[model samples]
Target: EDKTASDLFKHYQEIFPHGNRNAASHRWAHFVLQRSTQMTPGKVAYFFASFCPISGSPIDPTPQTAIRYESGHGLPQVSGGQAEGIIHHCCWPCICDSLKFLRVDTKTVSTSQGPHQFRFLVYGNPCTDPTRIPAEATDVTCSNGRLEASVLSDHGHVIVGMLQDNQPSIGASSREVLEA
Candidate 1:
């Protein structure tokens, strides 16, 4: 648990000489082979939930993003040598944080059931694109902001929301300590 990010990165590098996220099966081998990691079940769960912007949610898995950068793109520029950016696996927050670090203003919309966040490319200054926003980007929403456009709802009309009967996260512990 005390292992720094650099230590974990080194461990990954040792396993993946090429990279952690190649577009082929070679990268898959490392993830499949290294089935047992130091992360506990609770720790992993908490780690995943950290990516979510809010509480009370349905399962939503996002497609993994792959990016390849050149040497001049904030990376070391090697003379003549091919610039190999470190391809890696990233969660939602990791992606958003990186963009924000580059001065991109990212926004997250939170509601009763879950959250919604969007990203876009801006022209002048580093900023977020309003047109390329999340589906539930609007503040005035219905059914936890999970409703589709086909379903029409009047603002004054009443809308009902449901809760799941069995969900472990409903009463999970705040702390993710290892159990003996």
Candidate 2:
């Protein structure tokens, strides 16, 4: 988001004057510029803080500070009859050095033709619960994360991998999943 046209142009120029920005190879260079926008809407239902699960660094800053994390991981868990988001310390620098996945989980299916292997789709988004922090690793806590999704205006507890995007309501055919 911080990148400006000049910053991108400089990096582009380094090779562009030598590499054609366009397909006008016969004339040495040709170019086309393009741009687009994306909108991912999320709201903070509540606000809370605690240490990052992965790095164990105390992150609930006194001044409510936030590290400029290039990215982070969220694991959703249920506690006290409520759903919670557990923040993993997957921020930039630590992410570069840490092991993102401990193991590869695969599902094997036997069909009439042969055995097919399918990978699990794990969708993890930033936690929207602001007031609840995950119990520390050693604090007798449930750190297991699972997927959860819901459509606009749906206030139901959705099971991961069960609901499709933009579903209008809960129904009997929730188990009918589509393959990606």
Candidate 3:
């Protein structure tokens, strides 16, 4: 049994066999967990929860893949009670495609001196937006006071580029090593 497969998941050995789950996957999960805890510094449990804030899908059980994000990064608070800050989790696909999740509004207003550009980042209703952000979907872009909506758009493009640079190997290898 892999030592990293904690006691919490011991009973599910068949689903997460020793050979399939590798060090890289564990390292990635740990890095995400640590970063998440550092950012929120509260509510660490949400980091490991199987829920994906973006797609609302159950994440892979073994060698879980997750991207952590803060709540105000672009998520709607229908109840109007959501704290601007809280950690949330989502899958890689959701993180990679986050630019689409946002609704950007820009208007140029005439000020006393000149035209001023106002940019707004709007969060769509989760039910209507095809791209939903996981509590984790905040992506690295919005962490540590990087809460600008432009960051979300720029970061998503960067993520896509990184994935493309890695290409078939990164995707195929992660599945082969992490999937049960």
* Each model's lDDT: 0.25, 0.22, 0.28
lDDT digits (tens) for residues 66-85 of candidate 3: 22223334322223322221
Of models 2 and 3, which has the larger lDDT? 3
Model 1 worst lDDT window (10 residues): 156-165
Off by over 4 Å in 2: 1-50, 60-65, 69-93, 97-137, 140-180
lDDT tens digits, residues 36-57, model 1?
1444433222222222212112
Point to the candidate with the largest TM-score. Answer: 3
Best by lDDT: 3
Model 2: pairs clashing at backbone N, Cα or C within 3 Å? 22-30, 46-130, 47-130, 47-131, 48-130, 48-131, 54-89
lDDT of 3 at 109: 29
Candidate numbers, best TM-score first, in rank order: 3, 1, 2
Instruction: State the lDDT of candidate 2 residue by residue for 46-163, as single tens digits.
Output: 0112222234232322222222111123222221121112222324443332224211123333333344332211222223441243433122111233111111111222111111
The CA root-mean-square deviation of candidate 2, after full C-alpha superposition on the true structure, stands at 22.1
lDDT of 3: 0.28
Task: Give the range where candidate 2 is weakest over 10 consecutive residues by summed lDDT.
Answer: 39-48
